[model samples]
Target: MKRDVADFWNLLWEATLGLCALFALLNLFAPPQDLPWVPLDLNRPIGSATGTKVAAFDIARTAAPDQVEATTEACMAALRGADVQVERAEDTDDGGFCQVRGAVRITGGDVTPLSPSVVMTCPLAVRYVLWDRQVLRPAATEVMGSDVARVDNLGTYSCRRVYGSVDASARPSEHARANALDVAGLTLEDGRKVTLLGDWDGAGPAGGDGAVLLKRLRDGACRVFSTVLTPDYNDAHKDHFHLDAASYRLCATGPSRTRRAAADSESG
Candidate 1:
C-alpha cells in the first residue's frame, strides 16, 4: 500500500512536469493559430461582375494574378457603373504601379487616359483618387453650372516613403507600390484649369468649381475607401486628397472650419 501511494505521487509529478514542458514548447516554437491584431471588416459584401471576382484581401505589396484581375475588374466596373468610357487597359511596371490605362472621356470631350495606381496583395487599397469624371459631370453641372471635362493627374508611382517623422530606410510610397496617387490638376472642356495647389482654396479661376468638386469627391471617396484625407485636414494634406484602404476608420474633410475639429478627433 505504501509503495502504491509513492508510485501514484510519482506519476502525478511526471504529468505536471509534462504539462509544463508542453506549454514551454508551445510558447517558444509554435506559430500562432489565431491573430488578435489583425481585424477584418466583413461589412462590405463581396460582389463581382461577369468577367472577374472580388479580391479576398487588401491590395498589399505582393499581389497574385487573380488579385490583380479582380481589382482591375472592380475599378473598371466602378468606372463603367458611373458611365465612364475606358479607352484602353495596359499593364505597366512604372515603379510597382500595375495596369496603367487610358480611360477616355465620358463627360463629353476628347479621349484622355486614366492611369490608376493599384497595389498587389492589397487589391482594394489603392493610392489614387480616381473619379469617373462622367459621374462628376452632373455634379459639376449642378454646382458650377457648366459642362465639366477632364480629370488631371499630378503624378503617380513615386518611389518614396511617407513624409514627416514617420519611418526611414527608404520604403516605397503608396504611389510607388501602386497604392497611392497624387492629383496635381484638372482641365475642363471649357478651357478651365483647376490645379490642386493653385485652385484648392479659391485661389484661381477654377477655385469655386474645384473646391466644390473636391469636397464632393472626398465625401464620395470616404464611402469607398477606409481613409480619406483632404486639403482641410492638415498641412501634410494641403495639396491633394489622400485616400486609402486603412480598414479601421473613414475620414472626410471639407473647407469648413469644422474640419480642424474633425481632424483632431480622427488622429486621436
Candidate 2:
C-alpha cells in the first residue's frame, strides 16, 4: 500500500513538471500579449495575459505617486513602441477628489483620430487605440460593409460624481480624472452615421447590420477596458457607451433578469 501511494505521488510530480515545461516552451513562441511576464504591446492582439497587463496601467491612477509615474512611463513605452503619438499633459488637481495625473492627449501616428479630441489617462488611451484597431475597424468592415473614418466622443474629463447620483459622498466617476471615454457615434468611410441611441437596437428584432456592428464594438471594448457601460445598463447611459480603465472591472450591459430573457439585447 505504501509503495502504491509513493508511486502515485511520484507520477503526479513528474506530470506537473512536464506540463510546466511544455507551457514554458509554448510561451517562448507566443505573442507578448499571451505571456504574463512579458511587457504589454499595444499592437499585439488581445491574448491570455492582455487583461491583467492592461489592468496594471490603472495603477497609474490608483497607486502611490511614485508608482503612478512608473506605471505611466511603462504604459507610454508600450504605446510608443506601437507607433502611437502622444503629448503628455501637465498634471492637475481640482482642489477636491478629482485629479488628473500622467494624462495625455494622443496627437497622431498610426491611430484613428477622435472627433473633438480630448485628453485621457495612459491606460484609457492605450485601450482606445487597441479597440479602434482590433475591434471597431474590423467590425465596421465585416458588419457595416465600410471602414471607420472618425470616432465621435461626447467628452472625457468631468469633475463630478457618477451621473444621477444624488449622494454627495458617491464615488467620483472615471471621467473626473480623464480615465474614461464616452463614445457617442462612429462615422464610417462610406459616410453612414451610427449612433448608440439610434442604432443600438438596429433596424429589426433580430437586428440589422448596424445593430450587429454596434454590438460587436461593445463586446470588443469589454475585452480591453476594465469598465464598460452600455445603453442597456440604464436610461442614464442610453445615448453613449461609457468605457474606462479603472482599477476594478465591471461590464454592466444590463440587469440580470432582462439579460436572461434576451441575451443579445445589449452591448459589451
Candidate 3:
C-alpha cells in the first residue's frame, strides 16, 4: 500500500513538472506580437447574416492538396456562418505563384460595409472579417469612442509583383493571388475619418485623432495579418497598410523610405 501511494505521488509530481515545462516554453518561444493583451469590445453590435460556425485553424502550406481544398471549403462556410457577405470570384491563374484558387469579393459583414468593395481569396476575406470583428470595431470604440460605419479599403487583388521590393525579378506578390489587402482609412459613425496618410507617426501623433486611431489600427492589423507593412515599413506603404496572409510572418513599424513614384498604384 505504501509503494502504491508512493507511485501515485511520483506520477502527480511528474505531471506538475511537465506542465511547468510546457508553460515555461510557451512563455519563452511565444510570438513577440500578442493581441490578446488588448481586449475586444464584445458589447459592440454585429450584423445578422445567419448560421453557426466554429473557430478556424490555419491551413498548413505544406499540407496535402486534398486538405487544402477542404480547408478552403471550410473557410467559405465559416464566412457565411459569421454572416459576412461574400461573392465567389472566378478562378484566376496568372501563371507562376499568382494563382487565386478560391477568391471572393466581399461586400459587407453583419453590421459593417466595406466601401469600394475589396476582392481576395476567400481565406483572406475571412481573415479580414476576423480583424474587423475582433479588432477594428472594438479598437475604434476603445480609442475613439465611436463605432466604425464604413471601411475604405485601398484594395485587395492586383496582378502584380511584390510592392516595395527593389528586385526587378522578385516573385509575384500576395496581391497577385488575391491574398492581401491595402487599407486606406476608416469612417466613424460620428463622421470622423481616420486615415493612414494624414495620421501615421508624427503626422498624426501630436494632437490628431487620426494618428491615435492609426496607431491602434496598425497594432490591430499586426495581430490579424501574417505580414503587416505600414507607413513605417517603406515609402511605398506610407499611405496604406499592406496586409497579407503570407506563410512567413512580419510586423514592422517605422518611417517609410521616400519613393519617386506614387504609392497608390497596386504595384507600388
lDDT against the true structure, per candidate, is 0.49, 0.83, 0.68
Top candidate by lDDT: 2
After TM-score superposition, the amount by which residue 133's alpha carbon in candidate 2 deviates from its true location, in angstroms, is 1.3
For candidate 2, give the lDDT.
0.83
Report clash pairs, candidate 2.
none
Query: Which candidate should be chosen as best, given TM-score against the real structure?
Result: 2
Off by over 4 Å in 3: 1-69, 164-168, 202-207, 255-268
RMSD of 3: 8.7
Could you give candidate 1's per-residue lDDT for residues 1-268 as a string of tens digits? 9999999999999999999998777657643312222222222221122112222334434667676566566654444543444322344465432333221122322223333322222333222212333234555666666664555655444455656223555544545444444555556667776666676777677757677776666665655555667666667776776755444564856554456687888999
Per-candidate TM-scores read 0.51, 0.82, 0.68
Which residues of candidate 2, in runs, are more than 4 Å off? 1-23, 29-31, 60-67, 164-166, 204-207, 255-268
lDDT of 1 at 130: 29
- Regarding lDDT, does 1 or 3 come out ahead? 3
Per-residue error for 213 in candidate 2, Å, reads 0.6
TM-score of 3: 0.68
What would the per-residue lDDT of candidate 2 be over residues 1-268, giving only the tens digit for each residue? 9999999999999999999998888777777778888877776788889888877777543568888778788888888888998877777788887899878888888888898888999888989989988898888888878888899999899888998466888999989889999998788888888888888877533248877887888889999898899888877788889999887889875553356457665542
RMSD of 1: 13.2
